[model samples]
Target: MSDMLSIEQREQAWVFTLNRPEKMNALAPELVLALTEGIQAAHQQKIPLMIFKGNGKNFCAGFDFSDLDTASEGDLLQRIIQIEIMLDLLATSPSMTIALCHGRNFGAGVDIIAACKHRIAAAGTSFRFPGIKFGLILGTRRFQNIVGTQNALEILSSTRTFDAQEAQKIAFMQEIREPEQWPSLIEQAEQNNAILSDVTRRNLYKVLYCSAESDQNLAALVRSASAPGLKDRIRAYLKPN
Candidate 1:
């Protein structure tokens, strides 16, 4: 289990890194479960700073669809929605999550970063919303809040890749750095994470946004995601371009 994700905790900081460099550190069910448990551990340990990144060149390549078999499309979608809900608990934890993003961010990868309080990307990294091609929905509302409605629409709609410079221009990422400079840049990011007092900022989230309703609706829709022909469509879309 530790092989899937590595967690390091200190008095003030908790770092969770995706450990599978192969397959670009893709998210498997076990990895997602470990990440949820790690977030819980951070709360119990009173850690207020959280950093999410990858062990190698990529952040996360989204859900490991290869793990799915003949499960009902509904069952698979329910699992995906469950993963989303559980992952959100990390952001709502009594910590400030800052993503040090490099390489490619696709599908749920993008959603994870959007849910973070702050993000810094390496200049060489790229961002994309592949959900459009797959006929899936992503963090539209959260992304819109970060990068604005127009850009968010364009990003989600186009499914095209964008470099870090374009990402910063749209305010999707804060700072862009060369890979060599990420260590010092992340250290500085830790300083920013320290500003939040020892308390949950979830209230701030709910005050500015009422996402529960949308979440419920999304969960319901996603739970029933076993629409006829869904699997066929997914199989077709997943074929390498």
Candidate 2:
């Protein structure tokens, strides 16, 4: 509903496009809430597939730090928690999900891509998960599940920027695709979805996805983020010498 996120029913899928291109589609509070609501609606409507893509140069820049200076630590923590909730919804959704990423993505942006069933990126797209650098454990379990514990630890500890090729190599990204080829990918996904009834597909997802960790993930995030001086830690990470 918010201008920050555009939701459209395209063929058999609900396309949720990040609409704030100027800010690299960062997940501001409003944008996060909008995304959460959209996913909820998609679940309720039994949409067969959901696609997440950005409108501009990048998919998402991660958690918006534009308002950090004016925002209190409590406000920042709440925002982070909201993002985690949205990610959990995407991760557990019965509908097939795809994240079409491009440009540079960071922090929670990469987390969003990790949540989806299909993670695709443009050739030059890159990603970084800097939450650990700020002493926040957001999306750690999910990342490990996608890329394995050792790979996740190596990447997170170093806070390194990895290109799309490397992401696909480690299975962080399911495929590296050019923007022009995304339509075909979507078509293929639709075809795959059509093979099963909605109830059958939902049951399949239930058995395949281990959502038992959702509560633990949320708790870990809260504990890390609730530690004293969250804002200070973020500020230092943002302006490292």
Task: Give me the candidate number with maximum lDDT.
Answer: 2
How well does candidate 2 match the true structure in TM-score terms? 0.97
lDDT per residue, candidate 1, 123-196, as tens digits?
78898877656566646667788898888888788888988899899998988866688667667767766665
- Against the true structure, candidate 2 has what lDDT? 0.93
TM-score of each: 0.87, 0.97
**Candidate 1: what lDDT?**
0.74
Itemize residue pairs with steric clashes in candidate 2. Answer: none
Residues 129-220, candidate 2, lDDT per residue (tens digit)? Answer: 88898799999998999999999999999999999999999999888899999889888888988999998989999998879999999999
What lDDT does each candidate get? 0.74, 0.93
User: Which consecutive 10 residues in model 2 have the weakest lDDT in total?
Assistant: 7-16
Per-residue lDDT of 155 in model 2:
97
What is the clash tally of candidate 2?
0
